[model samples]
Target: MKKHIFTLFLLFNSLVLLAQESYFPERNAVWEQKSSSDFKIDSEKLNAALDFAKDNEYSGSRDLRIAILKGFEREPFHEILGPTKKRGGPAGMILKHGYVIARWGDTKRVDMTFSVTKSFLSTTAGLALDQGLISSTKDKASDYIWDGTFGGEHNSKITWEHLLQQNSAWSGELWGGKDWADRPPREGDIDDWKFEKPKESGTFMEYNDVRVNVLAYALTHVWRKPLPQVLKEHVMDRIGASTTWRWHGYDHAWTEIDGLQMKSVTGGGHSGAGMFISTEDMARFGLLFLNDGKWKNEQIISQNWIQQAIKPSEPNVNYGYMWWLNRKGDRYWEGLSENIYYAAGFGGNFIVVDKENDMVIVTRWLEPNKIGEFMTKLKEALD
Candidate 1:
């Protein structure tokens, strides 16, 4: 009887702690802020970290069209196939226990978020799994997508898990972008890459925009609607995200679904047209993940999916289901928690979730190379 009472007491304390961390902002409402001292964070150190982020802006043209072309200069035939935007100055927010502890620059400015859209793409897949639209991740893509995209024998073996992990090695052209041409290895010419034997679906990992778009396309067919709609209905609205955000696809990516035309969105802005969102919305998304897919009393996404999404895939210890893990791998950040996972895009946009610290850090237009040092300083502030 005494042990039972003790267990109940611990459970009660846990509930109280959760209530303390449950603050979430309403739509268009002023987000509540708390001082660094309120959370026992060193204000001086926190300011230093923010200053570091401000001092190191992304060294790219504000005109993203030029930035995209120049950044992917090595990739043959790479061009802006969709909409591009002129980015705002460096912006970000630091959320501690779902409350803003620090903010900088133009957090309200909506800008193109490049590959960070992959994380959002993967979230749609997670939603599908939760809703029983997808039975299992281990199921073969060909089983669901009977279209010629997965018709070939090699492609037929590609599973949803493989695609989510970016190990599918799906070789094909989608929306005028060829898999071989997306990001050809520096060591090889176009002829060599195009003629090279396709790696097994689950064996090799290659970051190809074409393959990522293929996942988006497949998910669209499965969901029977535009992915942005699914996200807005099930996620953004529930999380109180602003309506200014937009998800776009290539101009030619239209498809007939249920007797109506819908555009299949890209997983990233490699060829343009992905998620264009404000920093605050990105923070809300990050907060949802930090809380393990819950918003107040509602479970927006299943906890099981969140767990699987963050688990490192065998091909890359630093990558999960479209999320970048801070494991001691090629992309690992020195002096940060191994549990830190993030949504990273080109031009240094990132939504970093530090679960151990109950914090989410959104940094836009910071130098990509300086993230490690920035994170180290942020961690020091917490200490």
Candidate 2:
């Protein structure tokens, strides 16, 4: 009887603690700035977290367009997706209890957030699933994308889940780019790449932009509208994201849909066109996920979809539906919960969501190697 009473007391306390949590931000939500003392965070530790972020900035090329062109080493880099813009220096913001605890750099500057766009693409897919355009993620993509794109026997075996998890190895040329040309075997010669044995679909994971673009192309067909528009109406606008952001596709990524020329968006800023968004906007996105896709009283992304979206793929434990998850013990700070997942981009753009702490972190242009340390210091600041 004593044990039962103790359990009941603990449950009541948990419920009371939950009741004290802050409300989710509404549309055009007011930014509430609070000091470390307000949250019981150690001021010195919070300062250390800020200093660590300031000290560890992205040391890569300042002119991101030039950097991308030089990195690709191919003239195809000249093919602009949408509109390329100059990126700013390291910047970030931290939010606890839906209030800003810290921020740095140009939070409003619009800059390319490379592969982090993949998570947006994933959200679009979730929208499709919610609308019933997709019967099941396990269904073969070729069944719906009946075009020759997925006609090849090997490609036909690829499922939507396989594509979402980066395990599909889908082969084809998209927008004048070949599948094998993307992130080709680092040690192999041209001949070896051309004649390499194909792995079965869903058997191996490869981070190829070409295949990622394939997902964008397939999704564009399903929606019959520009993905940017889909995203705007469904997510960004709903989340009260700023109007400055844009999603871009390659110059040749345009296709005729319903008698209109529609551009199929790229999954990342790989060739210099992806999500050009502000850090605060990205934080809003993170906050949405942190709240289990709820914004105020409305459910934005279904909790069931969120669960499936974060489920680890067989081949990659650290990835899920385009989101980078910190599932493994060694991948993130030990002090943080394993439930933490983030949308990461090249040149160190990141939006980290921690449900347990009701925290959202947005960092732009931080050194990738120092993220764990940054996270560790941030965790220490709590209480």
Candidate 3:
């Protein structure tokens, strides 16, 4: 009788675990508030987390829009494809089990997510791979880009994986921007940048926006359609993202595709005008990835693709594809799982996803370095 009771106990525990619904909010899902007691969260710790985010908010340039344009090469900035937009202040929402636990500032205000746009760019590549638009990640990028872009022998050796991992070291100009000029080393002068030897593809991991833009251009040629449309039809709309988000490219980035002049969207807003999206839409995106590219039982981005995208590349362990990983003590925090990964951008925009705790923390302008502190305190609140 005791043995039978033990069997029944195991069955009951399994059922309980299965009964817990994995929340996926609808297009009109409201931010229904619940007491800390209901979610087993520490009220004190929760308040502390909120306080930390509020206190250490983004204290950068107040007019980043004007400042960013002035900082870059003026002529090229003016020649870029799309118009730049103004940015907003510190704001974000913390979602636990698909419900907003805490939100601060203006969560609905759309803002430039900087390099966080790389994560979306990476997702587009995942979609391409899923639909067999490209055969494999290891395939030579030159195979798809028949144009003289990857003409040189060195650049020809670059693979899709190399580009996605930011180790391609792809040379040549795209949309009037030189590879070296993208993000030159701070210590170096123009001559130093001009003379620097380029590393072999997949060897060095330099965060160059030009190389990233090159990846965007190559993907554009493959799809023969604008990236924003691909994203909206496949991923964003399915995930219930708002129409406020806009992916902008430069002025000269336009090309005649399928008899129409289409702009090749950029990977980020390095030069200006990248993904201007709201925190709520960003949360939905984070939730999609947290559930491994599935939305309401449909596989939007392949699970295999996501697994590959997140794995640590040999060049940089803390970076996978375009997403930032928490491996090797980078972005590590106590009381949080080591598997935590996030989409980080310039000016402290972050969409931090913790799969273990089923949480997605979106913060805009929260002081880049202080993210670890904020997350550490926030995780402690989850009890």
Whole-model lDDT per candidate: 0.93, 0.84, 0.82
Report the alpha-carbon TM-score of model 2 versus the true structure.
Answer: 0.92
- Once fitted onto the true fold, the runs of candidate 3 whose alpha carbons sit more than 4 angstroms away are 1-19, 69-82, 329-335
Off by over 4 Å in 1: 1-19
Report the CA-based lDDT of candidate 2 relative to the real structure: 0.84
Q: After aligning candidate 3 to the native by TM-score, how far in Å is the CA of 288 from where it should be?
A: 0.4
Give residue 179's lDDT in candidate 3 (0 to 100): 83
lDDT for position 192 in model 1 = 77
lDDT of 3 by residue, 62-122 (tens): 5766545554542322333455666677788877666677888898888888889999999
Candidate 3, residue 328: how far the Cα is off, in Å: 1.3
Cα error of candidate 3 at position 289, Å: 0.6
Over the stretch 240-322, how does candidate 2's per-residue lDDT look in tens digits? Answer: 88888988888677888899999898898867677889898898898888888888777888888888888888888888899
Q: Please say which candidate is ahead in TM-score: 1 or 3.
A: 1
lDDT of 1 at 328: 98
Q: Name the best candidate (by TM-score).
A: 1
Tens-place lDDT digits, model 1, residues 7-102: 999798657645675579999999999999987799999999999999999999999999999999998888889999999999999998899999
Clashes of 3: 4
Provide TM-scores for the models. 0.95, 0.92, 0.91
Superposition error at 292 for model 3 (Å): 1.2
